[model samples]
Target: MYKELFIHRLVQSKEPNTLPKLLEGLFEVFADFQGITTESVSSTLIDLTFLEEIRKLSGNINIAFGKTLRDIKCTVNDSDFRKHEIYLRYDSVKKLRIVSVDLPSSSLNKQTYNTIEDVITAFLKQISNLQSYFNELENIDHHCVVMEPIKPLYKDDYRNIRIDDKTWLHLEVTPDGSATNVHLIGQSEIWQDKLQKGLLTWDQDKNIVENIYTIFDIKNQSVSPTLIPVDAARKQSSEDTIGPTCGICYCAQLPDYPGLPQPLCQNMNCDVYFHKNCLFQWLVACEGGRPPAFGVINGSCPTCLQPISCSDKDC
Candidate 1:
C-alpha cells in the first residue's frame, strides 16, 4: 500500500524527460525578462539624467538666491523666480524669461545654455546684474527730465529718451551686453539728415545715463523746489518778501521750472523777473507763433516794452 501511494505521487508530479525541458524553457523565459528589465533601467537612466541635474541645480539655486527665489512650481515648464520689482521665471527646463515694467521677455542666447548647470548659472548671473540696471532705470524714471521712464519707445526693444520738446533718442539695450542700437530723432530735418548722412554720430562707448545727462546736463542741476501754492506763497512771503515774483504767474516759483524765475531782461531799469518758459511763450505768440532762430528770442519785455533777448536754453 505504501509503494502504490509513492508511485501514484511520482506520476502526478511529472515525467522526468518532460520536467527538464519545462525547467529549461522556464529558465529561458526568466532570462529574457531579466534582459528586458536591464534595458528598461538603462533607458530610464538616460532620460532621468536631465531630471536629476535639474533637481540638483534647483537645490543649488535655492541656496544661493533664496530670497529672490520666489517659488518652485512642480510643473513641466512654469517655475517662477519672482521679485518685488521684476517679473522673472523659468519658461522651460532650459530657458529663463525676464519681464520688467515695460520690457518684454528678454532671453539669453541658446548657445549659452548647454547643461542644466549652465542654465541656472546664467540665469542667476543675469538677474544679479539686472538689479543694478533696474535701480539705474528707476533713478532715471524719478529724477531725469531728459528721458521718460525707460520704456519700449518703439516696436521691440527700442527705448525712448526725450531730451527736449522735439528731440529724442530711440535706444536699444541688448540683454547679453552686446552693442547697443541708438538712433537720434531730432527737432528739425537738418539733424535727421545729418544723422542719415553719418555726419552726426552717437558714441557707443559712453554710458547711457551719462549720454542722456550730458545731452540735457541735468546731472549737475539741483532738484527744483516744490510748487508753492497761493496761500503758502503768501504766508512765506509775509515772513520774507524780498524775492521777485514772476511777471506771468505772479508766483515766486513756477511749478515745472527747474529753478527760480530768471532775470531774462537783465535791465536794471525794468527789474521785472519772468519765468523763462513764460517769457518765451509770450514772445513766440507775439511773433505770430514763429520761434526765433539760434535758441534766442528777440522781443520786447512785457512790463518794460524794452528790447530783451531770452535764451531758450534757460527756458
Candidate 2:
C-alpha cells in the first residue's frame, strides 16, 4: 500500500522532461524497500542546525506583514530513513512561522493512509503546535533561556535558541549527563581581546543580563542564570592602569568586575573596551545623528563589519 501511493505521488510531481530518468532511478530502489514512508513524499530537505535556522530567520526575514502562505517540508530524520519528521511552515514574511513539534508516526497513520490528502491533513495538524520566533518572550509568556543547561535525558531536545537579532545561544550537552554553562560574547574569554569592541551592542540602558532574561522570556519572578565564567575573561578596567581604552570616549575600561555593561571591541584583536553608554552614543553617531528607534541599533563592528552582538571568535 505504501509503495503504491508513494510511486503515484512521485510520478505526478516529476518534471515531464525527466520522466524516463526519474522512473529509471525509482525502479533501482523499488526492490530494496518492502515499504515506503512519508519521507518519500517530497524532495525538499533542510539540514539546518537549530542555531543556523534561528540566525537565518532572526533579522533577515521580515514577517511583520505580508500575504500569507504556508508549506510543509518533510526531512529525512537523521535517525532513520524509513521515518520522517514534518515541519509545518506558515509564511509570516516571504515565509517564516516555524516550530518543531514531535509528532509520532501513529498520529499520521502512514501505514494505512488511503490518499495523499490524508498525509497532508496530518501535517497541517502541526499548525496547532506552532511557536512563533518573532514574538517577544514576555508577550508569548515564555522565557528566552540563554543556553539553558541540558540534562543527559534532554540532550537531544535543545534547539538553537535566539534572544534577539544578534544574540545566538549555544546549548551543549556533556557525556556526564551535564551541560555547558551559558556564555555570552564579551563575558567569555574565547575572543581574548585582540579587540571585540562595542560588538555586542545593546540599546540605551539594556545590559546583557537584562536583555537575556527579557528576550528569552525567563520569568521575571523566576531566578535562572544567564552567564558563565569564561576562562581568562577581561574584566572591568582600572582607570589608573593604561591597558585598554574605550574606542568611543577613550576612557579606560574597568577590569575584574561582575555584571558590568562596559562594551568590548569585539574585533578580537583590538584593545578597546567601552562603557555601554559610550558605545550607545557612538552607534547613534554612526546613524548620522539619528537616535535609534526602539533603542536598537543596526550594529555591526566598524572594523570587521560582523554582528556586534558578541565578542566570541566565531562572531
Candidate 3:
C-alpha cells in the first residue's frame, strides 16, 4: 500500500503539496522506525538525524530536498570538523558536488562524486584523518600545563585554553591556518580594561599553534608578582564587604570563596553582584540568553533587566 502511494505521489511530483502529503502519510508508519526521524525546518527544508548507528554513521544530517536537484542540499554531521562544514548538493543525475572541501584538516583532492553515498564516505574518511591534528592539540595542552585543562567547544573551532586558575585564552584557528578571533576571558574589568588600553594584542597572520605560545608568554610577563590575587585581597567577612548579593544565589560570596562576587550588573541603580560561573549558568538557562561567543555569554541582568555579560571560565 505504501509503495503504491509513493509511486502515485512521484507521478504527480509536479504538485506542490504532493511530497509533503506523501511524507506526512509515511510518518504514520515510518515514525516508529528505529534510529531515524524527520523534522521540517521550513517549507522546503527537512532535517533528519540518526539517533542510533545506521550504516556505521550517526549524527545530525540536514537534507533539503527542493523541487530541483540544484536546490537539494545535504550537510554531513560536523561534530568533528568544527566550523569546516561539508555540504553536498546534487548538481546532476550522475554526480554530486561537494562544497568547501578546502578545509585545513580535510583533503581537497576530489570535489566531485558519482553518488551521495560516495561523497559522504569520502568526507568521513577525510575527517577521520584529523585524529593526528586532535592529538597535536592534546600535546599542546600537556606543554602549557594550565591550571585548568583546555576544552573544545561543541560544533565550534574555538578552544578555551586556560592560562591559570583565573585567566583563559579563547582561541580559534581559521581555515587558512591563521590564529584569529583571540579573546581573553578573565575578571570582566581587568581583561576589558587591558583590551581597551591595548595591553593585550593578537597577530592574526601568525599560526595558531605558534601564537598560543606568544600570547601565553605576553600575558604572564605583563602581570606583576607583587600583586595579590583577587580572592586573597578580600580579608574581610561577607558582612564587612560592601557589595550586592548575587541576584540568583542571593549570596555575598561564591561558594568556598571569602571574596564577594566578581560580576556585577551594568546598571548604576541596580548594583547586583554575581559569581561569574553562576551568572553564566543563569543566563544560559534564561529566556533571552544569547549564544556564547568564544567563552563570553551575553544576557540581561536578573535584577534590573539591564544588559550584562559573563565568562564561562572558572576563576
Best by lDDT: 3
lDDT of 2: 0.36
Rank ordering of all candidates by TM-score, starting from the highest: 3, 1, 2
Model 1 lDDT, full chain set:
0.45
TM agreement with the true structure for every prediction: 0.31, 0.23, 0.34
Using lDDT as the yardstick, the better of models 1 and 3 is 3
Scored by CA lDDT, what does every candidate get?
A: 0.45, 0.36, 0.49
Q: What does candidate 1 score on TM?
A: 0.31
In the range 1-315, model 1's lDDT, one tens digit per residue, is 343333224323433333234334334443444323323433211122333454455432432111222212221111233332323343333444433322335454434333545544555555555543444444444444323222322113334444333344555555433225656543334334544554234455654565555444444333223323334433553466444577877887655664444455634456566777888888888889888878888888899898877678756
Cα distance off (Å), candidate 2, residue 109: 59
lDDT of 2 by residue, 190-241 (tens): 2222113323432335433344444444443233243322211112112223
Q: How many residue pairs clash in each candidate?
A: 0, 31, 0
Ranking by lDDT: 3, 1, 2
Residue-level lDDT of model 3, residues 193-263, one tens digit each, is: 55445425655555455556553343354564533332333332223544446667888655464334533
Model 3: how far residue 90 lies from native, Å:
15
